[model samples]
Target: MSWTCHLDETDVQEYVGRVLGTGYTVADVTKMHGGAQKVVYKIHCRNGFACVLYVWDLTKNYFQEEIANERVHERSFGGHSFETNNRWLRNHGISTPALYDLHTGQDRYPFDYALVECIEGQKAEAYFKDPDQRVRDEVLERIGSMIERMHANHRQGYGKPDQSGNPRERCHLVQLENAKEQLSYIVLHNGSIRKNHDRLLAVLHELESRIDSRKRYGFIHGELGPDHVLVTDRLEPYLIDIEGAQFFDIEHEHTFLELRFGKHYRYFQQNGLDPNRMLFYRLHHYISLTSGGLKLLHRGFPDQVFASNLADYHARNTLRFMEEWQLDN
Candidate 1:
C-alpha cells in the first residue's frame, strides 16, 4: 500500500511557475528537515522572494494505511494550521509568514498543499552555543510565553483560575486511541515491541484518568518539539510543521519543552525556568515516542544514537510513571 502522490511529477516546476507565479524557477529541491510525509523545500524562486513549498505524499509514513484512516479524514490539517497562524498574526500581533498561494487537487488526488512566504532567519536550535546566559534566558522565556499564548487561545476567556484544571479534548483522545489501536497491530505479534508499547499504554491510561477528572478543556498543540519552533535573528519565534497538530491535553506539549530545555535545567534554573510541567508532558512524550519506536522497530531501527535514546527514554518514562502516581486498586 504505497501512496501515489498526486503531484504531477512532470509538471511540478512548470506548475510552480504558472500556478503560484513566476520566479519560482525551482532554485533547487532540497529535502526538508524531519520526516517524509510532506516533502518540505525552501524553493528559491527566480524572483527575489523565497517561498517554502510543502508537497504532501499520500503514501508517506504517517499517511500509511495502518493509522491515517483513523485520523486522516481532514486532508488539510497542515493548511488549516497555516491559516490559524495567518489569523493569529492578523489578530494577535504576531508575525507569521504571509501565505502566498494555495494548491489543492481534490479532482486528482484529494490532497492539498500551499506555497507560503518564507521568513528569513536562523533556527532557534542554532543558538544553543551562545555565550550569553542572559540572552539565552530571554529567548527561552520568550518561547515559553509564546506557548502560553497558544494554550490561552485553546482556553479562550479562561482566567488565571482556569489554567490548572482543563481536561483533555476529545479529538486528542481519539488520536491517542488511534495510536494505541494501530500500534497494537505490531505489539501483539512482536514481543519486544509489545512489551515497551504496553508499558507506555499503561501510563497513558492512568494519565487519561487524571485528565478526566478535570472540568475544563483547551486546545493543545499536541506536538511542540523544538524542531517545530523557529527563532529568527531578532529573537522572534515562528512555529512551523504543524500538520500533526491537534487539540489535546495542553500539558502534552510540555514534555518536549522540558526535554529540550531540561537537558540544561540546572543552568536554566538561575533564569527562572521551571520544570514543573514535566509530568503530563512526559505522558504524551511516552505515547508519541512509543508509537514511533514500534514503527521503527519494524523498519529496522535507526542509528544506534536514536535507537539508544528511544530505548532509554521509553524505559525511564515507564518506570517514572509508576513511581510518580498511584493507580486505582
Candidate 2:
C-alpha cells in the first residue's frame, strides 16, 4: 500500500484549530516546497496569525525502505529530532524557527507533527539572486558569520544531537563506509557510475588515506545551504529545516557550502580546515547526492525532472572530481 498522506483543506483546518486554540479559524493552508521526507504547510488564520506546520508521515518519505530503516539515526526525521535540534541550537545562541508545539505520538494524528513560528522573509538563496552586488555580499557575510559562530561550539565526540554513547567508528571512517554504500547503489542504477566505478572508488580510497584523526567536532546544520536560511527585513538569518543539526567535522559542512553556493562560497569559507578531509568529504557528498537523487527517482518522488537532474549533475561531478584527482597525483 502506498503510504502517501494527502492532507485536504478540512484536515489542515482541523489541525490548525486544535493547535491555535478556539475561535481562530484557518484562513488558508498552502503547501510549501522542499520537503522530501515530510509535508509542510503554511497556515494562515482568520485572525491574521500565521505559522508553519510540519508533518512526518511515512507516506511522504521517498527514501528506499531499507535505507530509511537502517539510517534512522543518521538522517533527521520525525518530531523528536526536530525538537531536540531546535532546542540545542536555541540554547547555543543560534537563530532558528521558534517551536510552538510538537506531538510525537499518534494519538492526535497518524504521524508526528509540530507547529513553528513562520519566518517572514525571503530565503537566502533567493536573496543571492538580487541584482545588487552589495545585497548579495551582505547576505553571504551574515551567513558566514552565523556559520562561524555555530562551528565555534565544539564537542569532544561527533554524531547527531539525539544520538547517545561514544561512536565505535571514527567519523571519517563512518563517512567512508557511507560513501561506499552510496556508490555501490549508484553503480547498480546509473550507467555513468558503472562506466567509471573503478576510477571513482580509487579516488575515494586515495582521499581516504590522506585524512588525519581529530578530537574536536563542530556543531553544524548538516544540510545547510542558502535555501535553508530565512533572512528577515533587518538582514538577520534564521536557520530552517534544522532537524539534521549535529556535531561533526565542520569540513563536511564547508564542502556542501562550496557545492551549493558555487562562486559565492568564498564568503562562507573557513580557515584551518583540513584539506584532505575536505577533499574526501567533497567526493563523498557528490556520491551521496547521486545515490539520493536516484533513490528519489526510483521511489516516484513528485519532481521527476528534479530527481533526474540531481542524479545526473552529481554523477557528472563525481567523475569530474575523480579526473581532477588523477591529474593531481
Candidate 3:
C-alpha cells in the first residue's frame, strides 16, 4: 500500500532538520530513476554530506506480506532490511551502500526514509554495448568475480540471512503458492496455456527431486540484473537494491546471472556442479518470470501500460523456453 510522495526542497530540508539537526541544510534533493515501488532521491547537504534517500511508498508493498516492521499500512522495514543486508555484504567484501540514518515515520512526515552513502557510478548495463571489446570483457569478468565472492559465503539453511533464526517454511511456502497461482492464471488465459502449464509443473517436480535439501546454501542478491549492477569510472562494480537478501542454492543465483549476461555462465561455474541441476533451475526461473508477468497482468497494480508490457515479456520468455526445451530433450 504505497503512494507517490512528491517532496520539494522545503519538505526535504524539514525532514533532514528533524533527523540530523539545525546546522545542516539540504542543498539539493534530486529524485533518481528506477524505483518501481519506492521514491529515491539523492540528498546533498550544505555541509558537504551526501546520501541516498529512500522514501517507501505506502500504497503498494514490494513483498507479498509486510516485512520486518509494519506500522498499520506503513512499511517500516524497507530501509532497515536493506541497511542490515548492506552491512552483511560489506562484512563479506561486497561493495554496497553504507547506511547513515533510517526513520520509520515522524510527525512531520508519515513514511520510511533511509539515508545511505551514495556510490557514484553509472549502471553496468551502460557498458554492455561498448565498442571496445576489451572494456566489455573486463567489466563482465569483474562482475563475475564479485558474484563469485558473494556466493563463496556458505550458510546452513536456505532463507534470508537477516532472519536466520525464524522458520523459513512460512516464507518458502508462500513463494511456492504465489508461483502456482500466477502460473495457473496464465494457463487458463493464454494461447500457449496447455504446454506452458505442463512444462512448468514438470520442471517443478524435477526441481524437487534434483535439489538436495541438505546442501549448504549461500547468500544471493536474488535480484541481480544488469540495471542493478553499477560501474564506477574506475571499473568497480557495485550491486544495489539489496533489500531482501537471502541465502539459497548458489547455482540458482548463478543461473539467473547467466540468463542476464549470457556470456559469463562458464566463468562462474565450478567443477562438479551438476549440469542437469543447473538446467532445471534455469527452466524454473524462466517459468517463474513468465508467471510473474501474468500475475502483474491480473493485478493491474502497476497500471495497464506496465501490465501489458510485462505480459509481452512473458510471451517472449515462453518462446525461448520452448526452443531450449527442444534442444534439451
The positional error of residue 305 in candidate 1, measured at the CA in angstroms, is 5.0
Highest lDDT against the true fold, candidate: 2
Off by over 4 Å in 2: 1-19, 64-67, 71-73, 162-165
Question: Which residue pairs come into collision in candidate 1?
Answer: 3-59, 23-46, 23-47, 167-216
- Give the range of the ten consecutive residues with the poorest summed lDDT in model 1: 156-165
Relative to the true structure, candidate 3 reaches a TM of 0.80
lDDT of 3 at 85: 81
Q: For each candidate, what TM-score against the reference?
A: 0.71, 0.92, 0.80
lDDT of 1 by residue, 91-207 (tens): 654445666766665565555677766777666666667799777776767776776666555442211221242233343355457546645664654455566665557666655
- lDDT of model 1 at residue 240? 68
**Model 2: how far is 211 from its true place, Å?**
1.2
* Least accurate 10 contiguous residues by lDDT in model 3: 68-77
Q: Give per-residue lDDT, candidate 1, residue 84.
A: 55
Maximum-TM-score candidate: 2
Candidate 1: which stretches are off by over 4 Å?
Answer: 1-10, 18-26, 34-36, 72-91, 106-110, 155-207, 212-215, 263-281, 300-308, 323-329
Model 2 over residues 144-216: C-alpha lDDT tens digits?
9989999998877787766662454357887888888888899898887899888888888889888877778
